[model samples]
Target chain A: MKQKVYLYRAFERFWHWSQALIIFFLALSGFEIHGSFSFLGYQSAVKYHNMAAYALVILIIFAIFWHLATGEWKQYVPTAKNIKAQINYYLLGIFKNAPHPTRKTVLSKLNPLQRLVYLGFKILIIPTMVLSGLLYMFYRYPQNGSIEGLNIESIKTIALFHTAGAFILVAFVIVHLYLITTGTTITSNLKAMVTGYEELEDTTKSQLESKNEVISAEVNNE
Target chain B: MKKIVISLVLIGLIIISIISFVSPKETKQSKLNELKAELSKKTTPSVDHSKFPILQKKIGSPQEVTEACISCHNGRAQEVMQSNHWNWEREEFIKGRGVVYLGKKNAINNFCIGVEGNELSCAKCHIGLGMTSSSTYSYTDSKNIDCLVCHDNTETYAKAPEKGGAPDQTLDFSFIAQHVGKPKRSNCGVCHFLGGGGNNVKHGDLETALFEPSKETDIHMASSGMNLGCTECHKTEKHLISGKMYSLSSMNRNRATCEECHTDNPHSETVLNQHTYKVACQTCHIPVYAKVNATKLDWDWSTAGKLKDGQPYEEDDKDGNHTYLSIKGNFKWGKNLKPDYIWFNGTASHYLLGDKVNDTTKALVINPLNGSYNDRNSKIIPVKIHRAKQPFDPVNRILIQPKLYAEKPGEGALWKDFNWQRASEVGMKEVNLPFSGKVSFIRTEMYWPINHMVSSKEKTVQCNECHSRDNSRLAGLKDFYMPARDFSPVIETAGTGIIFFAFAGVLIHGVIRIISTRKRKMKV
Candidate 1:
């Protein structure tokens, strides 16, 4: 039997969807500003990119506080116990219709591999983009307005880092999109995210049913 | 928890608003106090000239006035005669270029041509009296020196044009002579501000506004802050000014520079101090010039004779800048101009009267600021590049200074008759230079170094101004690589190649994993 359980909270859904929208908008505008086709024009694209970046920062700050208050940060605490199983499940086991090594619950929403990848994205890629973007925005400062002879290595470094981080994020998003489709049904996982409720197999209920039968048989023998 | 987050956000925004609004007002108040303190340090001239008996005498010619002045102040006229202001000559052996004899007298400029036959008009700027075309003036004569041009403190003394450098006849000469004292900013700017015929025409950095300037116009000469006079930086010896014009200077040593007062290591950071080796102080300090008035950017002499029904026509551009004028040819003027950057080692090479130019398609450089990025002594400096299209001899391939000003009409003056050939021949004859009689307008450029109208540190250009990728101000400078602005093709290729290989590896890995998974599933 399958039972529906509440998964993502209301604020969590809001943060996730808003962050996704802002990132998508930022990527579209940023590429346009980088002279890739230029649909919105360069000037308008730059303005939109800056506004989206600020929106993303504000969302990130709010999401951080929410995650801490709800203690949902523990979901991303990665462990190596089910790492091999999860990798095999995706590589070969999933093709043969094997069961998943790690079960989803309210306390443990993300699997080990998902936790590791998301943790890297959160701690490394996102921060790198934010910091490098800031440095690129204010590259000429800290010289006290005497910029004539100042050598600006910081600007070049920031540009390279920001570009590299964007590529990493793009690759992560591609893999994440593919992994989300690996659920029991294509629309099932996406529906769970929208409604904040997921239907998982009642494994504990089945175990208790078998134990109750043994206890009844023992009582008959007595 | 949500309320707490909202409250924190609101508080953070309030703090930002307060800082953005209130801090600037505090800084402005402090700046005002600093300026007031600076002004209190200066003192006006002490020696009153009104009580002197020698100055009270009635004067006939300017020479007589000079004679009476030199009787009391001995050797003063001799000192004035030795200066470049009086002699109009600069002789120095510059490096790379050989011994150069160049000055305003011989240096051919695009504006008004040379001063050979037009001495009566040009001598208005001269420090001597009665310097006409036919006048056999002796440099040794003290009576020929003009004393009132510099020492006048009454502010009423004015020079009459085409009067052999004499003062205006209506001016109270005795009163001006009585009030003679140390030169003010007005006295120095009377000729300099009005150089090349009108206000804000030549030397884009200087203008009449500098007489009672604000801190925004000039940091050093501001009435409130520093209150510096011309002599502060142009420190003179025996009435000979220390600074030389870029069109004439050839000497290689001891020119007035910001490093003389402000040490090379002015910045707090050591890295910034090290930059002084390759960058000039004025480049950052005076980010722009011609802040107070519009300066002449270019003059096209070929369009001088354009007329509407036999009357001289004048036109203005979309920006209200003077684009065409029949009396003074075509002109392009601009205010608050950005300076072109150059590497200069404090020396300039001028195109003397007979010097051959490279080509007519390109501008003949009246004077080029000499330096290279490879030169250790060179520093990046800012300059106002004034472009002009003036007459040059096609046969000789040299610039010809056609006499443009004439006392009367149709006397071989380019302005009067709009005849280039006649004016070129007559002007060349006066200077003893041969002319082939073939005159063609050629583009020419003069580089004027920016050294004034410095804004406060807060008003300077921001960092992205130069480091930007498109339409950057520093795009023309290619000697030194600017990060984020310039890129290496090899490095870019390698970086992109790495990313491509990484993406390919991920695709290959995913394909292999899927192939193995499919085979295992088939066996099961």
Candidate 2:
């Protein structure tokens, strides 16, 4: 049996949509600056890319604060449980109409594979992109009488790293979009993200609180 | 959700409104108004030379007029005598060769060779009179300095070609001396505009077009714009000009730069201002040279001896430019040409006479502008590279300085006899350098740094001109990484491959799931 339950909060839905829009705009403008194709023109592309970068940084800051305050960060913590089953389901069992390796609930929203992938993106890819992008924006060509140690002779390494990060992020977005269709219905995940409500497995308020408490206790033991 | 969406739309509208209101239109209007105010504030001369009593007397010869001028303005002649214009050479300290005197007298250019045995004809551009021969012309003589050439505002004083730099006998010296004032554009343009034996053949930036230029030709010298004179930027003090050409100069001293007047941080945008450290003002400002006239691009002396009906002849292109001359050579000209860019640090090295040509297979750089990306003082600058194929000694491996001009035939001038052997013998004897008695054509290049005919702000080079993937102006510059022009091939391939594979994987997986779901439904 299933019941209609609030899966995403208002702020979470807003953040998700805003990030999706910003990332798409960034990829379009970023590739233009990378000399892939000219759409907005080089000067306009640079200006808008920089503006979007600032917007993303602000959004990320708010998202981070919200996650920490709500204790929702624990959803992305990796665990070995159901990891093999999840991999097998995607590889072969999905064609056989097999059941999902794990169930989604308000207490723990992500599966083991999702947790690991999301954590890698949060800690590695996003941070690298942001840091390298900031360096690209702020780095100055050393003029006469400039400080010796502050001299950055070349931007080759920084640019290459930022470009590589962009490629990885683009690949992640492709897979993430595909994974959205693997829900109970083709549009279920999309509808949930938009309305903050989905038909999830039934769990009463008291049952969800107990499950959250048990997960917190387990985390403390580790 | 509705409130958030509405508020976001309102915020975007407000931001766009603010950006639209604060446009650059107002700034551009204010700048134009400021220029108008500056143009109206002209300096009124304190004294009129037309009323002077000394100029009322009869001026017989050009030297008599000069004497009368010296009598009133005492010690001014001494100042003009010490200038490079009067001497035609200066003491420059080359890097490897210390304390060498370099000038048109000693410097060997590919055009018309040199001025060793052809002083009579080459003296047409000289500032002094009586340069019949290089060996006989006295540099210490102060009387030879022609004061009226620079100060005559009458615009009628003309130098007779091949007459030892003398004034035309038809000119009224008395009227010119009476009307003398500050030098006009015509005074400097007379020789400089017609250098290398033709109009606009030498420096692409300087030509007759600058005399009364339109705004499109040169913003600074435009009659409708700033109307600035040559001395405005090439500031002169005691007759010693501050500007130095890399063709004759070797040291990084007394150079005229745009930064001298306009600050280094001239641009409103910090991103553009940062480019000042590595890019010169002229690199973006002067997009192309030879704005109104076609300048000489290539000259091949090997084809000079071609004659018709046993007589020297000349051929002209459709544009009235000289295409070939039996005395000179085959010529190629270009108009409104995009300048080549190179890293320059204000200093240059020249190929001095008697210097051995090490590489015979490649064109020799007559004046190699010195700098690199590693040099802190270096900046990318625009240049007009004039290439030529001139005569050289194959055995001695030295660029031969041929005597190109003679008043009559049988005088061992290439123009008169069209004999390379006789011309080379006389040229080598004049310069006192061994010529190996053998002459052959060798390719050579000369770099003329573009400095004038700067366009307005609207006509300046855009960012994509140097930042685009194809046909970038800075394509030759590979030392530093530019945003759109440079990328790592390996990283690009790898990144693209990953995206392709991920996209393919998702597409295949989606197709297989659909096929299996249909099969299960059919069985049920």
Candidate 3:
């Protein structure tokens, strides 16, 4: 039996979709600026890329506040438990019709592998991109009065870092899209992200009941 | 679900509003336009010189008129005497080559070689009245200054060709002297526009079209635009002009810059404003030079003296510009030309007359505008490069200063006798420089910075002209990194490879998963 459960919240779904759209736009415009291709023309590409960057920054600030306020940041705290099992399931078990080694619940939403990847995205890739991009935007040629303590002589290094980060982000989006299909059903993850609801196995109900009993015992003791 | 939809719509609306609010808008009014508008208001001169009593008498000569003018304006003649226009030279301290007096008197150009033996004919443009030869003319005589040449309001004042800088015999000196007020565009254009023996032959930006120019010819000098005179931007004080061409000047001082009128940060866009640090205003403003007239691009003196049936002849192109002359040589002219870009730091070094030719294998740079991307003062500027193949001394390793002009045919002038050996000997003897008795043609180049014929803002160089991958305006400048035009091959290749592989990997993975699932379903 399958039971429908509320998974992603409204704000979380909004942030996810907004970030996806922004990243895609940034990639398109950034690559155009890199002279890889011409789409919106060079000037327009630069203008739009700069605008989208600012939008991404604002979105990131709001997402950070939201994560901290709701304690959703803990969902991405990587753990060793069931990590190997999750890896094995992806590598071999999924092809042989084996059952998942981990179960999803309201409190712990991500599999261990997903936790590690999301944590990496938050701590490493996102910060690197943001810092390098800000430097690229604000860096003045030394002849034009320079920023204090940031005597950057050239934009070559900053541009390279930003371009490399863009490539990494594009690659991540590709893999993330493919992984979205590996859920309960081919479209289950996408549907949950969109509608904030997913159908899980009935075993989650027993787990919820046990948690409720523990909460009642604690209340009686108090 | 309705709440989610409402929230999403609200977020989208907020983002759209933010973008619309922060995006840059087209500025309707700019400070430069306001300044131009203010300047366009015409002002009549406070005193009309047509009623002056000192100019009523019949003037004997152009020099006599100068003497009469000095009787009232006492110190002005002394000021003119000290100017570069009067002495034809100035004291300049060149780098590596100590303090030297440099000017047209001793300077050599690819066109017409030098002014040593050709002073009589060349004096048609000289400010002074009597310059029979370099050795005999008295520069100290205050009477020699031609006051009406610059101060003449009557456009009829003209110096006859090869008349030792004397006014045309037919001109009424008394009428011109009475009408003298201030120099008009025609006075400067008379000599400057006709430099190098023809209209618009030397400096590509300066031409006869500038006298009553339309807006497309020049914004500043346009009759219908700002309508500025030569003295407006040149800013003369005590007869010493503030601007000096890098070809003639070796020092960085006394240069008129765009910053003098329009501040350095003149752009509405921050990115463009920042570009002022490395790019000159002329680089973008003067997109194409020689706008209305074609300027001489190449002169090959090696082909001179090639006559049909021993009679000197000339050939003109469809535009009436000279293509070949039996006396001068073959010529190439360019119209509406895009200028070459270079890094200039206001300082330049000239290959002066008698300066030994060090490299014969390459085209000699007559005047090198010194700068590099690493220099703090350097900025990229547009320049018109005039190339020529002129006579040189291969044995002495020096450029030959051949006599080009003479009053009569038998005077050893190359134009008269068509004999390079006698002309080179006489020219070298006049300048007190040794000649090898052997003349060879040498390829040489001269750089003339384009500072006029400024286009309107709408027609200025676009961003893609320099920032694009193909046919960039700055394609020749490779010292520094420019975005879109420059990138590391290693990083670009690696990044592209990673993205390509990731795309292929995902496609293959999706296909295999589909096939495997189908097989499992069939077995079940």
Candidate 4:
């Protein structure tokens, strides 16, 4: 019987959930800060938004360090093998209860599609929010200086980018919520994140084939 | 063969991915240090030019303040005290007809100075050099609100406002931050915290600072909280040891030219020249009055709203003299305006707008004066999508009449230094009705007088006429409404971020796959 291995470390789980919560608060409080919905009123919402942003930044710093030291960063590196198959399974095969073509193993857990998406989240979306947020926080009026050599009036662009990043986060969350449901038992995948234990299916014939191939290849070489 | 090729490609991809993932920063540590050094700029404390010993005193001490101030602006002094402004004393009334005594019953208005006697707290508003001194402040010096008193940052004055003018700059801004772009609304915010005072007073047409600028508003009500500067309009030279016209009068005393973009002839040269009012035309023409035509009706009414008493309104079918008073508020014009004529003439210039409403529909024309018009022939003004309206049309309320203002392109007499327009009544303190604290606005005509605009709330009311545009007051709130914006520059910043990572990831994966494939092929 195949059991879900101890793949994600304790810190990884902590970082994941904490990062998610912080991002969620950031988006919620950020939009409120924009006067989208007055949940905490304007001032309080601003306070929360700034706090969550700082918290998020701290998480990101820690995450960077963790990824570097553990070298688990390999998990997010995009791969082409079975990528099309993985995409196809998500689009068509999943509905038919087809098994994931790219299995989640201890060495290579994520499929190519996941690796690509994670890469995007790490590189693109994450940085967009971080940079835009920093720009928003540090944006200033020059009492005796020009704004970036370009004397163009208004910081509306900074505002627009910040808002756009917020919307992107919203979209990511919507899609993520949907994707989280498509796990093994809906409950099974969720339970893994919650309890760090996934009831993975038994190892299949491919492992046996690779094992035999490895033995025979060694014998043949001799 | 296919399996071997696939394995080789996958192995090669893994190797490159490993290396690329290991490094994200392309710049070396030394280069990063250099860049950091390039970005950091040094800052120094502001230099104070004032010689008044009080400038360096502890603020808010009664002995240092009240005693020192009254000596020069003495309550007991005669000739200097006669000027209504200097007579900071008043009596209050307990009740009935609100006895218009020499002063206020409450100390608030300095009724001794027309303040409501008990409300003496209001006396603290007029700030200046001797605020904290024990000896009487030297009143012989200009008593006008000193610009330096509030705008304390003298060291890097120019940097306070960015290129076009915005509040986006901070007091502690590095030189680099100012060079890039100014913040939109925070510049004037620190001192303009209206509610922070012991008494919460918000004196302005716009809502509280806590509220957002409504989306429905025209660019005229630009978000005041964003990129803000004190001197886009109000430039300063020295403290007003000699009384200086507040920036509001700067445009008139040394009239600031109208916006260059506003080149159309609202004021015909003949009428403009004939009407030798040195004040900005906006002052009297748009000044809030009981009625534009000297017609003071019993009730306050707008052309759009009902009577203040919650009574429904009915207007005469045609333009006629209101022989009798009605429930609707009177439509009083400024000093020489004719509301009756304006009401009748405005019928003709209805306009059409392209994209003011919903996605496909046109915008509806609303009253720009924020006043209700007398219904014509009982016909309601057409409020339709894409429909045009008053205020935008030159004919509606141009400066030609009342002839208070002028626009000289180059070197007209009025168009000179300190060309600030007057301040709105929002800045006025009703010490005793007509004779009030008209020290002019603290900032320039272009810059909003956020201080006065946020102060002087309650116990006194400034009709929109009082707060409306006037020669004394430039179309400050108007300019503040519509700031310019361009998005193209930042879009690339967003796009490049997304694509860079995606491409880098693909390149790493592809390179690793190819290398693996080549090694496997050679092994075979």
Once superposed on the true structure, which residue ranges of model 2 sit more than 4 Å away at CA? A141-145, A205-212, A216-222, B1-36
Best by the DockQ measure: 2
Which pairs of residues clash in candidate 2, taking residues 3 or more apart in a chain or in different chains? Answer: none
Q: Candidates' TM-scores?
A: 0.66, 0.93, 0.92, 0.38
Residue range A148-218, candidate 4, lDDT tens digits: 56332434666676666666666666556656656676566667777776766665553456544633553
In angstroms, how far off is B142's CA in candidate 1?
1.5
RMSD of 4: 24.4
Candidate 3 on B1-524: residue-level lDDT in tens? Answer: 53655465568658775765554434424567677777778778887665777778877788778988999889998899899888888898889888889987678898887788888899888899868886678888999898988988878888888877888867888888888776788888888899899999999999999988999889888888778998788888988888977777898899888888888888756667778888999999999999999999999999998778878999999999999998899999999999999999988888888889888899999999999986778999999999999999989989988888888888898898888899898888888889989999999999999998998888899877898788889999998878888888888888878888888987887787788899999999
The per-prediction CA RMSD against the true structure, in angstroms, equals 10.5, 3.0, 4.1, 24.4
Predictions' DockQ, in order: 0.06, 0.57, 0.43, 0.02
Q: Model 3 fnat?
A: 0.50
- lDDT: worst 10-residue window of model 2 chain B: B1-10
Count of clashing pairs, candidate 1: 0
iRMS of each prediction in angstroms?
A: 6.9, 3.4, 3.1, 18.7
Once fitted onto the true fold, the runs of candidate 1 whose alpha carbons sit more than 4 angstroms away are A1-222, B1-40, B44-46, B134-136, B307-322, B496-524
The model with the greater DockQ, 2 or 4, is: 2
Q: How accurate is candidate 2 locally (lDDT)?
A: 0.86
Error of 1 at A25 (Å): 24
Question: How far out, in Å, is residue A45 in model 3?
Answer: 2.0
- Report lDDT per candidate: 0.74, 0.86, 0.85, 0.37
Residues B1-524, candidate 4: write the lDDT tens digits.
Answer: 43453354345445554554454334344454563364344344343223345433444322233343444445433343333233332222212223322221211100011112112123233332222211233444433222222333323322111111112223322222222222222323332333112111121222233223322221222244221133332333331112211211111122222222122223322222222222222232322221111221112211222343654344431334332223222332112211111111111111111112222123222222111222211111111011111111122211100001122222211111111122111111111222122222110001111111211112112222222223212222322111111223454355445545545644564455456557767778
